[model samples]
Structures are given as structure tokens and as C-alpha cells.
Target chain A: AAGMAAPRRLKPLHHVAVSGGTHGNEMSGVYLVKHWLRDRSFAATPFLSNLRAVEKCVRYVGRDLNRTFTAEFLSSAETEDEPYEVGRAREINQTYGPKGSAQAFDFMFDLHNTTANMGTCLIMDSEESLLPMHMCHYIQTHYTQSSCPIYLYKLPGEESYSIDSVAKTGLALELGPQPQGVLKANLFAEMRALMACALDFIELFNTGTVFPAFKTEAYKITGRVDYPRYPDGEISAMVHPKLQDKDFFPLNPEDPIFQPFSGEEILYEGDSTIYPAFINEAAYYEKKVAFVKMEKRTFSIPGLHTLSLSPSP
Target chain B: MTSCFVIHEAPVRRVAIFGGTHGNELSGVFLVKHWQENGAEIQRTGLEVRPFITNPRAVKKCTRYIDCDLNRVFDTANLGRQTTEDIPYEVRRAQEINHVFGPKDSDDAYDLIFDLHNTTSNMGGTLILENSRNNFTIQMFHYIKNALAPECCPVFLIEHPNLKYATTRSIAKHPVGVEVGPQPQGVVRADILDKMRKIIKHGLDFVHIFNEGKEFPPCTIEVYKIIEKVDYPRNKNGEITAVIHPCLQDQDWQPLNNGDPIFLTMDGETITYEGDSTVYPTFVNEAAYYEKKQAFVKTVKVKLTAKCIRSLLP
Candidate 1:
């Protein structure tokens, strides 16, 4: 989108915030916001999260806008007036949230894309949220054409920091294999479909249409794995052909994971088979992450209290 | 270390170096500054080297350019036009550069031009952006590639689909040098600088050899020949929504097949390469190109032959 219009103040029966461009270069949400901004009939208070970054086509000018949403970070906003993102983060919070407080969005859709082959996945801050889990299950079942996977990225002990984490109830829509600053038509349509589906779910929820109980499969984050490095800490190897682009696939023990410049294949010594995603993600190079491993578990949606009642998940 | 000077050393007439064409690319700015301060250390017999920072305002601001990209404003038409207050900063700079050392088609112009640039792409130590008539540039690259390690001498020859040479290098009667890195903007890496220094030294030596009556062998080198540019997946709003696929990340110079995965959605769907044949990619996820909205460029790997390297010598 050429220009970013400010978010419109809307008074919906249930205030739902649909955001794109939290990481400005990620374009699906950016264009969606731009398009909706031009005509707001379909948009329920559309928010173009990081306008400057969208125009510059960078992730952010300073720190990541998506990663600046934690309560602690928001509380100490004015203490360090350095990066441009901190002020923008506060502006977004004041506009849509101030989350966990009384005046906040009833629901939020934080759109994102990944270098990872994670498919049309729903990323949540907590797995214990009933409404989000139900929404994820509904979207996965309906959005069959798209590779929809659910991931509980934020664990038990982690603080919520993403744009979605700021909403009273929100899930970040993660799409991928598209490069930052570039958008694809097929994927764009898929994201649009998911958004419409999410809006429909919210509508149904408000209308008291109880979603039928269903089992949903999700990937649970365990730990981040970095590239095989030399003693000097330089990455000594790259993702092997077998392991490269195999996001959400089972990574077996003793599998050839890295191919060193010396032509030697490095194996996974861990005994348990773990599913890996975000393999060789461009953004993760700075983070030193080669991939992130997760555990796969099937849990039924709407388990009364939204707790995993079908044994340990 | 493999070859020795025969001592029939004839002086190199003139060579020009350009840096800070894009101010945000720090390696070029810093390297030129270092050379301007202490180029005498690398000084060899006969070659008269001149170094200049092409865009001072951009360099001072730590931006790619001030008014417009200096690299794109170097066409003869733009340079030949009389300067006006209405012209952009880069246009005026190009005119100044042309005045100093150009009318590049002329015989008195700089013998070889080294236009230094850095990128956020994983283009290790690339030499020569593709110019079909520049056989001399390729000869210098051949010498450097054989002399250096693989990481220090990767070849990425970009052939623009429609436009002919418009970069700062195009201003040179004969051009050579690199667009290097995996380095961020406004950042400098010593290792990359070291690589650039080696290439420059070897290039100077090659010129020395060329000036002498010594004949060099006919040569061929494999080059990733850039054919076309691929933009990131966009919505109807023309905004990009995907990141470089993990399969394709840091895969510069690697072969991409017909059905190879090129992009991944945030939702995890794989967007595949629909090309008919396998092609190599370069400038993969280049930071500067992000503003230009280019994800990466596709290239055909080719064996470029110097039909007669020695025959060019008079």
C-alpha cells in the first residue's frame, strides 16, 4: 500500500481489532489494512500497526514493533525514549488496547507471515484460552485448502509480548514462505479467507451459536535449536537437504540435520523425535536460530473449562 | 601466491574507485575512507588509483541516498543533461562524476573502475555485475577467483532484463569490483573488508600484467547469470505478505528447480517455483531491494568463456 491511513474509531457491538503490518514488511496485513482503509464497510476498526515501516519496507525502524507488547515493556515505555517503535507501540496500545484492562479490544487478529513453511497456522500466547482454541479449531476444519496449523508459541512461564498478546482474546495469524516486503496472490486470498472465517466465528460466538466440540491438533513449542557452530561460534554447517524446508515434519533421532562445509553430515543425537519449523528462516539468522522444535499433541476444543482433559498435552 | 610478477612491469595509466553511492552501505564508505587515508600501503608499480566517496550527503545521513539512489542516476542521458536546481542530489553527483572522469566512451577515461557496494544479502564476495562487452572485467575476476578461497570469490553476474548499465560502475570506460556481504546497513565487517582488499590487490596486479607484453591464457568461469527479478507475493493492495521461504533463505547461488519451494505463508503454505528450468538465485533477500520491492533475482548458471584473453593485449 502506498499510504497508511490511521485506524478508524469504530463502536462495534463487540470491538474486534483486525491488524496487519505489526512487522511492517509483512505485507498481507499491510495491503489488507490499506484496502480496508480505502473502504471500511467490511473492516471492523482496521488497524495498520506500523505505517512508517510499511512505507520503508523494513521490519521496523528500531526495535521490532511486534515484540514490544508486553505489560512490563508498555509500563516502562517513556523511561527510555530512544527507538521509534516504543512510542508507536504505546500509540497502538492506547488506540486498541491497554490490554488486560477494562477498555481493550474484545478480540484481535494480528496478521503475520514467516520465512518458515509453517503453513496457515494460528499462533497463540496461551494454550489455556478457550475462545481462541475454539476459533483455531473452527478455522482449521473450515480452511481445508490452506495448510492451517495451530502453535502454542508462548509457554507456561513466558510473558506475552506480541501484538496479539495485547488483546483480551487474540490469535496471531501466521502465514508463510513468502519473503518480507513481497506478497503473493494465493497466500493473500488464503489470509483473507481466514480473516473472514475468524470474523464469522466471532459473529457466531456473539450470537450464542455454540461451536460443536471437536479435536484439534497443535504443535507445542519446546526449544529453539541453532545451526551447528564451530568452536569459535561461527556457524560451521547449514541445513541438510533432508531437513531444509521440512517445517512441521517429524525430525527423527540420528537424522542428518546439517551439512558442513567439510562435507560431513551432522546428526541429531536427541532420542525423541521432534517436529521442527522455522528451519533456516532469514529473520532467525540474527537470532542464531536454525530451527525451532515442537511437540505435537491432539486436544479437543471446548473441553468445558478449555483445559486439556484428554490426558497430558 | 600461485603466480609471480615477471618484472616487465609497465605503469597502469589510471583507475577510479567509487564508494558511498548508497550511504547506508557502510563497508564501501568506510573502505573508501580507509583508502583515501592510506592507499599508499596497497600501492604497486605503475597504477595511478583515485578514490572518492560518490555521495557525501547520503553517507553523512547514514541513508541509501539523499534525493534518489546515485546508482540508478548514472545513465549517460542523465549525466549529459546540464545541472539545474530542480535535479535531485544523485543526478547532480552523477553529473559531477561524469565531468571528472567520464564521457566513458572516450579513450582518456579511467582504465578500470571499481564500484564498491555492500548488501544485506548472503552474497559472499561477489565480483562483477554482468556487462556483456566487459571481457576485461571478467579476466580480472578469473584471476581473482583462482587466487582466492571460494567464500572470498563467489560470482554473481546480474543482467537487468531491459535496461543497460546504469550503476556507478557504468561510468567507467572499463569496470570491475564487488557488491559484497551478509552485512547489515550502517554496519561494517572486517572479514568482508579483508576479502575486498585482496580482490583489489589482485585486480591491480592483473592490470600490471595486462600492461606488460605477457600473454595470459584463454579462460572460462561459472557465473550465476541473473535473468529476471521475482517480487514477493502481494495482495491486491500490492503489499507483500510473505517472507523468503526457509528452503530459499541464504540460498544465493544455489540451483532452484521447477517445483522448488520459494516462499512460505505465515500460515505455513509453501509457494513453489513455477519456472520451467532450474536457475540460480542471487541478491537473495537483499535489504536495499526490499525498498525497491524485489525479493530476489533468478539467474541461469553459465560457463562464460573469455574467447581470447591474451588477444585483447596490443
Candidate 2:
């Protein structure tokens, strides 16, 4: 029983990657990674994900690059008719992932920014993942200037689709309230600090420091809420002005959520209270998501340690 | 011919072009700078075109303003206030601007004022007028409308009785707001800038033609008249919990139906419009208006007929 309760030791990360510019208009990540490449300040391999979109200063040249990383798209044979993002996804998968494999990069950090005022958010693939959880825990406990919220994007057994999913273990660092195509100096600095902290955590873990078990809070995605639409598929309503920048805030049932053109207030009819993130995100409007609803859960993670290279006594 | 109102006005010789009213809006900030350096593009045979940046301090910092909104500081209440050592920066600037281009409703004021602006909303090139009934303004609106693509520019009228507007343009007898957008604050897009340039060119040309004794015939044109403004829903702590419904975003100048959705709450609830009649919305999600506690302004589409205008010079 004592042996079964022992801390789990995992393989040390050898190759870590940091990617940016998956959505071109997100200027913080795009410029941060570019600065890193030019300065050679950070040791991690800096990858600029979408060159064409970055040059154009648009979200993407073809389809959204972040959404183009599913198995169906990655494994499909390359053809002349394939979209630019699809081809890029395949190349990225080949370079970093071939995901869920031993040869895949140990960790990948994808940087993103939202027009929504989400502040600093860390998006993890699963609630149970140990390394990313430890990294997020480290960031939350140590980065005292601002509160960093952890968001669990994947449900149990769900397939991964985002660009960060290419690596074995990954997290998407999202910061915002900054508009697309514009760089806010404060946000850029925050992103840089967060990235440095994450890298420090990786170095610490690599040096074989054991991370203790702890309980932390995270918002898990439940379902997506789309904007109300007309019969012709045109969106009929907008994100309520009340919810414009209240990302990660508790939203109660029967609260005023939307204000239509008629100036009437719309109330939430859900039975349970929920916390929403990405409220009024500019990019999500085109994707039909008014906001992503989330359920707050407290997670207790087990202590983690790097695999012992020496023979056990 | 049927009944028509003919307008005869003294030559519109002194025209002032104001930019950087809200310093973060870059299209006007840069355009005004360009025209101030080289006057050939905006110059006319008989008119003295003065392109000025209203808030240079704010422009230097690339912010909206130093204290309060410069655009809202031009009202008589603020302008007539005693100059104190501790007054807000914009109030002083407004007074200085008034002293140069206006004294607000004085006969010595400039003949016409073209104040440039930008919005975060998807409203295309828009001409805003305080007095929708004025013959010269209506003729200018009609002329600019005829010159540019109809879908690119629309006229919006904010009915402010008693000349109570706080805008910089309100100082002049005839004020035309050349507002364009879908631009994010602090950022400039070539497409948006080019569209603004075209609108200004057409405006200058219209004035040039009018000064040369050309008469504009009476015509009926579609204009959006401001009805009211709605505020965002807030909690006890004043935190917002919803966003502009996706449907309503970027749908500026489009007719908003009674049952259409206008907002979506954070908890994924849909909010529908309950108005009895359809209305058009402008300045939807304007970045500058967020601080003013307004989500969007509603307007009803109406046809405005302008009288025939012949310059008093001829």
C-alpha cells in the first residue's frame, strides 16, 4: 500500500518547443516569438507557425490554422487542392509531433491572444495531465503580479484539434483584452514573463526537483454557446454587453446576459451557475460561438518526479 | 416643377479640418498630418483649408485623451468655464480650438468644419450631421454620396436641439463628421485609411464645385437618425457579463429586426430584441464608447430631402 502511494517519476523533457502566430492577428505571440528568434534570448526552439498569415497580418490565409490539427487532416495525403493551413498542419505534425509517440517533442508551448479580456490564461489538454498541471501550478503560485487561471479544454476521450496538440505534452498560453493586429506593450511584457517562468519550471523539473502533490482550481469546458441566428444563418443577437470582458468570472443563472437591438435584457435560464471564458472573443464570432461555458472544478494532482537514471536500491 | 426649397448662402471660404479628436483613432491622425504638410491635395481655388490635429498631446502618447474625451469637451458649459490651474487637459484644448476655428455659434466662426473620426464598429464611411435639415449639409451629403460607392458611405444624423453638442464640429455653422471604420483603436489598416482619403477628397471637391457657383438640385436621400443609446448590463460591482451578439457585430447600418438577438451572456444565454419596429444600429461596439457606458446607438432610417442650393457668390 505504501509502495502504491509513491510519487510517479516521469521521463525528463529533452526537446521543448514554443510556437506562435497560429492566428496572425494575435500580435503579442507573433512579436514575442519573432523577438526571441532575433535576440536568441530563449533556449527553446522558437517556431513561427504561420508565415503567410503573419505577413498579411490576418488570422489565416486559408482556414484557421489552430483548428486544422485533427487526425483526419494530418494523416490525409497531401493534394494540390488542400488548404494552406492543412498543409502547414501536416508539416508541423511531422516536425514536432507525430503525436502520442515516443519520438515526439516532450513539451510544446503555444502562445495565443484573444480580443476578449481574458487576462492571462493557461489552457491544458486534460485535467489529469501531470507535467502541464505542475507547470500551471508553478505559474499560479509564483507569478504574484496577476492571477493566472487554468482552463481545461479537452473532455475525457475527446480528440485534440489545436496546434499545441502536436506535441506529447502541451499547453496554450492565452493573454488578452488586446485587440487583434495591435500590440499592447503591457500584454507583450506579461507574455514574456509568463514564458520565462514556464521555461524556468521546465529547467527545474529537468534538474530532478520533485513537485509535491497539491489541489488547484481549473475551469473545464462543458459546451459551446452559439449566438442566436436567423433562418438564413445570419447571427441575430450579439454577446451581451454585460459579458463583454468578464472572462473567468462566476455567472449566475437568471442573470442579464444579452441586450438585443431592441434594448431588451435577456436572462440566462441555466439551472446551475457557470463560469465563462473567452467572453466576446472577436475571432469566435465568426465561428458562431458567443462564448464558451465552463464548469469550475478543483483538481488534486499527485506528486511528480523525473525518472531515476541511477539503479534503485 | 413640384415644390422645392432653394438655398442661397455666402461663399464657404474658411473651412477647418479637425483630426485626433480621439487620439487613438489613427486614420484621421495620420491623414491630418499628411495634409498639413502638403496642402495641394486638400487645397481649392477659393477656400482656405486648414488641417489641424485637435489633440496633439494625446496624439504624441497614442492615447484617446489626457483627461476627458476631447470630442465631448467642446460644449458651451465646458467652453465657457473659467480657466483654472487644475482644469482637465481636454477642456483647455477645446477652448483653444474654439478660439482658433470658432467661438461656437459666432458669425466669425469658420464657414464649415469637417471633423474626422474612426470607430471600432464595422460602420463603413459615415457622414455624421448635427443638423439634418440644413440645406448646405444635405447637399454636401448628397454630393459625397453621389461621388463614392453607396455601400461604403452612409449619412448618420444625431438630432441635438439648441446646438448642445460637445463635438468640435459643432462650433462651425455647417459641421460634417467624416467617420469611417471597422478599425481597431491604436492600429491603422491601409484599406480603411484609403477609404477615408477618398471621402475627404470628395468632400473637398464638393466644396470646390459649390464655390465655383455650381447649383445642387433638390434630392431625397436615406439617412439614419439616432433614436437612443443603450448601456451594457452590469453587476453590483459594475462588471459586464455579456458581449455584443455575433449577429449584431459588424452589421452596422443594417436593419435590426424586432426579434433579433443583440447580446449573448457569459452563461450562454440568448438575449432578443423587443422593439416594436425595426431599427438600424451604428457605432456598434465602439471602443471609445465603452468608457462612456454605451454599447450601441440605435437609429431609424428616414428619407431626408434637401433644397436646391446655389452659392451667393454668383
Candidate 3:
């Protein structure tokens, strides 16, 4: 069988962390983590990352906390005039990661929500690491009951800036169509179920179960398109209504991408078809990205066996 | 066009200010609550101003409505429908409201009714009038426009001449729907709330001046007359495929010309305006209209001339 042979044995996972409220307005993650905190389970641990932003119910008091985890930001000296997220990022680094260190947590899961109509997206950095890829493969196969699509963002050439990057290996669970301040009950339940599945996979991996090699599909980020803007920098066009909630749908060249206030259609000028993610994400409005362009890729993962008998010191 | 306008000679006596007609619209609901507790701000010498929350259940739940939209349930056909067990809460509420404030186009209706509303669209501060021929509403719109800073008020005429309206304010002799926005459905913006309060204050002040028998000079004002509504692009399954384009999203009250982008399809195609002439679009991307199947309401600019009026007093 193509998916049956085993080759590599990876170390058993020990310290797995789940984070929420990275963007305070994402209510599903925030509420799920809050519920977990109330439950007080030591085995299934989760924490709120941005307390100030969560308290105020705003994205962030200073700058986006999720984007403040880079080495440059973590290494920057403390200053009274610096953004609130900068100091908070350093504190988080000390707790979870000091980055690329052996002391870092074994795995992490960052929770997020978007105003864009992305449904149960599993965002990973890249396909370089084997463990995360295998985990993703497991999740994709096991979480078959719902629309769980995997996405590969922050490709090799791009710098990693997300909170999940602090761990040895991790991914972000981004769910949506939820307005910043509002939480849909369905999404909240879906998030809880997804988190539980991720935890189950960790337990399964740690228990020394052999996993078969399998081919899986993921959308990899290629580029981002910004909204059409005026001379004064005011956005002049909106994401075409047709494209608004069509996340992960293949967008062909010359397809309608934008509609200006003047009522003219702007076609996609790209040569090849591409899928889009984060379409009209409310948070990305300030970032100038209307939507992220993606290309679908299938990766073949090698079979994995846990190295539980020989624990690494 | 210099057409003669016949101004209403009756002095406005009782005025009703309604809020929470759409429960998610927080500006009006909160303002009504504030005024109900503190009456000093809305009080004037001759006018008996009353503040009311039309749909308390919706307001309490922070939803638009329970069974149906309260604002759209006030039509004569719905109002006259006999009470039944299966009747919607809003329909029953509308009947009760009609019994209290209106008989529907009768002489016993309130002299002026100003219904407060908010939109998710970026329509600054708007005065929605059903009848542009009514001089009282037009003059009030003109006064509010001049009293506040420029661009503070824009008159929108729905132009329903059939003597039938399903809106909360339409029951009054002179009705004005005060709609302000860019505020999210469930969220309140301090700027939007302040603008709404100012509009109401000026409206009451105008009524006071009219009751005191002041002569008003003839003036011409710009009115956005709604012609038709545009719906979002939908597939065979009736699922909306596109949304209001970003450039046209908040561009309410702005001119739309032929070949201008109106909708962006999910397939990455731009749907431009194919209209032969330029028209103004209002209520662009209203959140509440999603279920109504309306993307935006198209309008044309027309000059409305109002003649001088003096309130008749003994």
C-alpha cells in the first residue's frame, strides 16, 4: 500500500500549548480558552495570550499582537514609547520560546477568527517539518466530518511572525465569517471540537502509534492583493461581491476581483488561476491586503513511528 | 423647476420620537432611553415631545426583530389583519402602535413622527422622507441641513405616493425617518449617536419655531429620490456570490456612472453599472437588507423647492 511503510521515528510530544485571544475580537477561540481555564484541566492546557486586548474587546491596544512575535520585536529593548505588544511579545517569548531553542514547547496551537468567510482553516508555516505535516495529515483525515482545509502560509522565503512560531512545531486554527465583537454559537462549538481533535492527535502520537505515509492537499500562499486605492490612499474598490465569501475557490484570470465606487469591474490580471484565502478579512484592511492568493499543493508525508522508548534528554 | 409648494398651515402640537424600531440599531435605542430618563434635552416650549422604544423585546435581545422586522410591519394590509395565534410579535406590536399613535392616514395621527434608525452602510446622517411633496418634511430637512455643519444632513425621498407605508414614521402627518450610519448593527459609535441627537434637537427646534408662527423663505434643496434597488449576485441555489465592491461599499450618496464597478463576484469578476446615465446610490451595503435581497438602492438627484410657510394660530 502507498501509505503503509514506516521509516522515521520522532520523539514523543511532552509540552503542548494552546493559545487564544491573540486577536482579542476573535470570540470563538477566546470563549473556548476561557471555558478551558474554568475547567482547570492540567492535561489539556490553554491560555489567553493578549489579556489587555481581550479586556477591552479590541484587536490590540497598540499593534497587532500576533505579528509582534518576531526576533527583532522580541529582542528590542523596552521603552516607554514602544508599542504595548512589543514588551508583551518578549514576556511571551520567555514563557514559551526563547526562538529556535531546545527549551521551547514541543508543539503549539494558536487560535484566531476572521471576518472573512473562511471555514475551519488550519494554517501552517510550511511543509519543511515532518511532525507538523504528519499531525496535519492526521487532522485532515480524522476531522472529515466538517470543512477543515489546510493552508501553508509563511513559505520558506517569508519571515515567520505569528505566535505559533515560538514552539518547536505548531499551527494556527483560524475560523470565521464572525464579526469581531460577535460570536456565532456554531463556530464556537466547531472550534471546541477542532481543539479537542488536535489534543486527541497529540495523545495518539505520544502513545506510540505508528502512522502511515499519505498524500494530502493544502493551499500554499503565493501572493496577496491589495484593494484599489485613491491618490490619498483611501480604498476605492471593494472585493467583488462574487468573490467575497468564496475562500479557497479557484479564481481564474480575467475573473472579476474588484468593483470601484464608480461602478467599473476590475479583472484579475494574473496569467494562471489561483485560490484565495482571507478574502476581505476585517483585520487585514489596515494591512492593505484585500485577500491572500494561494496555489493548491499536495505533499507526500513519510510514515512516522513515535520514539517514546528513548526519551531525548 | 419653480413649482408652487403649498405649505401645511397647522401648527405642530404633538411630536413622537421613536427608537429601537430595528433593535440592533443602538444609537436610537440608547438615545430614547436617555431621553425617557432625562426629559430636559428634548423638551421645547410649545411642543409635546415624546420618546418611545417601538420594539422592546428586540432591543432587550439586541437582535433586529423577533419574528419580523417591526419597521416593515406597519403597512395597512398587515395592520388591518385580524389577530390570530399565528400572528408575528411585530405584527401585533404594529397594531398596538397604530392604536396608540396612528389610525393610518387619519386626522388623529400625530402631527410629526421622527423614527430613529441606523444602517451598517456609510450614509453619514440622512433624513428619509416618503413624500417629497410634503412641505413640512422638506423644510425640516432644509433647516436641519443648514443648522448643522455642511454635509451633516442629506434628504432621501422614498417617493411612495400610494398613501401606504410600512415604516414607523409613516403614520404621522409629517414623518421623517432619521437614519445615520457606518455604525455596525449591534455596536454604537459615539460620533453617530451625537449626530442623531443633534438632528432630533434641530427637528424639535424647527417645530417650536413653526408653532410660534414664523415665516419661512422659499428655498431649493437637493433630494435623493430612490428609483430602484439592486440585489447582490446570487447563484442557482440563491446563495449570494458577490458583495458590494469596496470602492462602492461606503460610497453612499456618491454618483454612480455607467461602467463603474458595483459588485465584485466571487469568481473574481467585477460587475459594473450598465445604466445609461449616472445615478446616485444610497444605503449601499446595508446589513439589514441582506435578507431583503437588496444590495443598494439607486436614486436620482432632483431639486425640491419649498414655499414660505407661516403656522396658523388663533
Candidate 4:
């Protein structure tokens, strides 16, 4: 129990513990946290008074904090044997408990950024959880000016796990593909407004007020392409240009990669495209592995209404 | 008297084309006609054009189908079959239309194809098919929604992957159906008529249709099905009854817990219990009930073949 120093007098209302940036590469969520910390006025609103006044705020920088919330990781914190993010997650959990008590914090939000090309999405653990979907709808409705298609997926249902595995309720706001400079700034503001909306809902829930349910029109991507880094000359270096208006990438099967000394022919084997073929060696991870766009079905769902079926007669 | 016109334009590369299948849904028909009437100006402005009218009888009748629904007759076998009294007229019209715009054996085929229409319901605007999650269709879906119906949010782009396949009789063609809202009086019909004109003009402007020099949006072929007909319960007096209550356009239908009554008819009542199943309810008036000649559910499962898969692949 690393940060279990003392049980201070809580404001006796619900608290929201937002933690994200689990993947060091994804930067949107980090900027969102930074935005919240800088724009204190959003957090200062009456809706957030209970937890805002007493709850200890912990912000983890660098490293994936989501993977560290296990019992072994917590025990290792005492020995100082675990990585910094792991130890930090342990400390946060100790202060908040495995599941933040009902008398304390009632919600969590994990923010993240995906590859710049993948569209915007909200990732959750269950279709039954309406909170994340509601927040997704609000953000898409209020913030994005263009036709920003918002997608929602159940975490474990999709064969993936995240920090939501630890918290009873949490939302992972995935900002599709990170743009370079000023656009990035605008993306941060959009993310901040989204955080405010989530925090606002949490406060309403704690006070027994009816939180406005989020209306959602669900969609799923139609195709994806993964570009895994292969041996020295295996992965080719060629510009995969996008067809006009179409998302298809034109890649010839016979293109070759020229490394310092070796070269190999490129094999185009997928149903999608890969643009900007340059590699950033600094990021040892696969250069650019995946591209996904939905075969979208846009149908509206009632706010906070997670019911899969229509009301009976 | 009702007149039908079919127009085709190949602005630049002739990547995609437009076909108005239903004459009653005259927006697309009129739009194509307007372009053809102003052909020289449009040509001077640079748009390669191709257009055709599908069912003149239905256009004259102001109904969905003429004889048999012309759209449902798209399966290959039905191409030349005289299935009804009007079969000769429809077949002749289809042959002439097919020869003009159907896929040529040459590689230079129209990139995208749109079949425009108007719905009987007040719900107006465009509906896009998500047969292929290609960039052009996705962008067009967004562009049309943002540029046209920003207020009613009338543009609906289907995002689901279609598990079932639909065959069109007019030869092998990638088709999309656009439904403008139902217009009864000729004046209101004119409003939709003008909107369709603007959409065609804008589409021409976007693609720079005739100007062979400018780059056009790369086309992605796709296919989708619109609810051509619906079936609803009718009363003893043959009055159409509303099954589920109508709510706001954006409102979510509430979930029924345990036992909930679905509908009440003079033929007795139908209730849904814990284990019983039901379909999504559609609002229908007696007029619509009669016009809804087909059930809303998919009764047949068509086998997916290698040919169909090849056709869909880019």
C-alpha cells in the first residue's frame, strides 16, 4: 500500500480518477490531462465541488500505467523493483482502493491517442456501460465541427483489455491520428471539453441527479492494414499514395526497399493503404502497422440507454 | 402529363454514373434532365455525361413500381423475361437504357453509380450505402450531409457491412439509392426538384465533370438495398394501425422489460413476453400499408460467390 499514508476527510461525494497515456506513443490523452490541470476553471465548476475539493490528483507521465494495476505490481512497489509507471499505478490504487469505494470516487476516465489515420473512437468494456458511449456522443456532438464518425467498442468483447479491467466504470477516449502542431492544439481543446463533459456527468451521478444519457449512432470500420517491422531489408521504403477520395492505397507488389547495403521487394497483401513510407528509427517499434476504416452503420441510440432491445408494447 | 428523362455524364474519366430507377422519385430524373437540357453549357464547362430514365409508367402513376417493381427485376434472369403485361415495354426500355449506360466490355467503366429517388414519408435527404468503406463514398457521404441538409441532419450514411447481397437487373453495376422526402403537391415536389438540381450541379462542380484535365475523386464501387416496400398490420375495416408509438427522429426507442404489449388489433391482440421475439416497428397509414407490397424482413439468403467477391474488391 504505497500511497496509503492517511485517510483524510473526503467531501462525502463521488470522485473521478482519470488516468491514461498507457501507451507512451499515444499523446492525445496526455495533452488532455495537461489541459485539465492548466484550465482549472473547468474543474472548479459546482458540479465537481465534492471530489474536487478533497481528492488527491495524481498524474503519471511517460510509460503505460494501465498495465501496472496488479497485486504483484503493488507488492513490488515496496521493494522499489518495478518500473516507475507500475509503482505509480500501485500508489494510486492504494490511495483509491481496487475499486474506488462508493463513498469516494465513483468514476474513471482513461484518455489515449491512436495512429493519426484511424478515426475517432470511445473504447469501453461492456455494451451495458452507457457512461462511455454517452461521453463519446457528447464529445462528437459538441466539439468536432466536421463529420467526425465516433465509434464505440466493448473492451474484452473485442478481445482486448485496458485500464477499465481495474475500475468498475471508465472510458478510453481515442483521438484518431495525431496531427502535427496547431491542429494538435485544437485537438487538445476538443479533448479538454470532452473531459469536462465526463467530469460533469460523474458529479451529477454522485449527487443523484439524472445525468443526460448520451445518444449514439453506432458504426464499425470496414477494413484494416497492419505494417509490422520486419528484418533489415524486408520492409520496403515506398510512398503509398491515397487514391482520390477513396481510402485505397496504391502499392505495387514488386516495389523494392533499399537499405544501406541490402534490398528486398515489397509485397502488397492487404485490402487497405499505407501512406508516408518514411521510417522513424528513433521509434524502434513498428513504423506504421495498422490502418482501419469502418463500414459504418449510423443509427441513433437513446441517451444513457444501453438497452439492446426496443421497449416492449 | 408526367414525362421521364434519363441522363448520363462522363465528366472526365467516367469513373461513376447516375441512374434514376423510379420515375415517381423525380429529383434525380429532373436533375439529370436539367444537365442534359443544358448539355452544351455543361460540356463547355467540362462534364462527361450519361443519363437514363428507368420506369416511365411509374413516373406517370406517381407510384413506386410499374407492373412489377423495376428495381426488383435486376437479377440476371429477369433481364429479358416478359413476366407481366408491361414486360415488353419495360424490357424494351431496359434494353435501350442498358445499351446506353450498362458496363461496357472495355476497362474504362463508370467509377460510381447513383440511383436517385424520393420517399413517401416526410423524412427527406440522402441515404448512402456502406457496401465498401472506400474513401470516396465516405467523403461523399460526409460532404453531402454537411453541404446539403445541415439543419434536418437529413443525410444518412449506412455504416454497417451488408451481410446479404443484392443483384440489379441492369447488367453488372455498383448502385446507390438516394431518397428525397415524399412530396404530394407539384409545388413541394418542385422544391425537392430544385435541391436535386443543385446537388447534381455541385457534384459536377466537385468532379469538374467534363474537364478532362482536372483530377476526379477516385471511385469506390458499392451496393446497398433500400426498403422498397413494407408490410404492416391492417384492421378489420382495412384501416392501418400503428404498432409502436412514434417518437422524435433522434429519440431512442425504449427497451421493454419483462412483459410488454406490442400492439392491439381488432383481430385480437399481440403481446411480447420474456421469451417472445419481435421485429422493429414501422409507422404506416392505410395508404402506405397498401403501398408496402413486400415484407421488411429478408426472407431469402443469397449465396456469396467468388464472382461477387471479385466484383466488390478494388
DockQ of each: 0.04, 0.05, 0.03, 0.01
Best model number under TM-score: 1
Which CAPRI level is candidate 3? Answer: incorrect
DockQ of 1: 0.04
**Per-prediction TM-score:** 0.61, 0.57, 0.56, 0.35
* Model 4 ranges with Cα > 4 A deviation: A1-313, B1-12, B15-20, B39-46, B80-88, B104-109, B152-174, B185-188, B209-230, B234-314
- For model 4, what is the alpha-carbon lDDT of residue B184? 25
Question: Model 1, range B1-314, lDDT digits (tens) per residue?
Answer: 21522222223468877888888676677667767767875565666888889999998766788888888877768877777779898889888887787766776666678888887677788886557545666677888888885544777676666833587777666776578876656544445565676777787788777766445555788887767889888778775556678778778888899899888754468899997898888888786776677888888877776634442333
Enumerate clash totals for all models, in the order shown: 39, 24, 26, 52
Q: Model 3, A183-287: lDDT tens per residue? A: 444666677778778888888988977888778888889988998886766566667767878999999999998865344789999999999999877667668
Candidate 4 C-alpha error for residue B140, in Å: 2.4
lDDT of 2: 0.82
- CA lDDT, every prediction? 0.74, 0.82, 0.82, 0.41
Over 4 Å off in model 3, which ranges? A1-313, B1-8, B160-165
Give the root-mean-square deviation of each candidate in angstroms. Answer: 11.0, 18.6, 16.7, 24.4
Model 4 lDDT tens row, B186-252: 1113355545545544554544422333322333222222322244455465433423212211111
TM-score of 1: 0.61
Tell me the tens digit of each residue's lDDT in model 2 across A1-313. Answer: 5433566799888899999999887877887887677676578988899989987666898899998889899999999988899999999999998877788889999999986778999998887789999999999988887999999998677788998788889899999877766554467778888998998898899898989888899999998887666576644444675676788888899886765423366788899999988876767756777788999999888889889688877
Q: How far in Å is the alpha carbon of B213 misplaced in model 4?
A: 8.2
- Residues B147-260, candidate 3, lDDT per residue (tens digit)? 996655788888745423479877889888999986665544446777898999999999999889877778788988888888888878665666577568678989999999
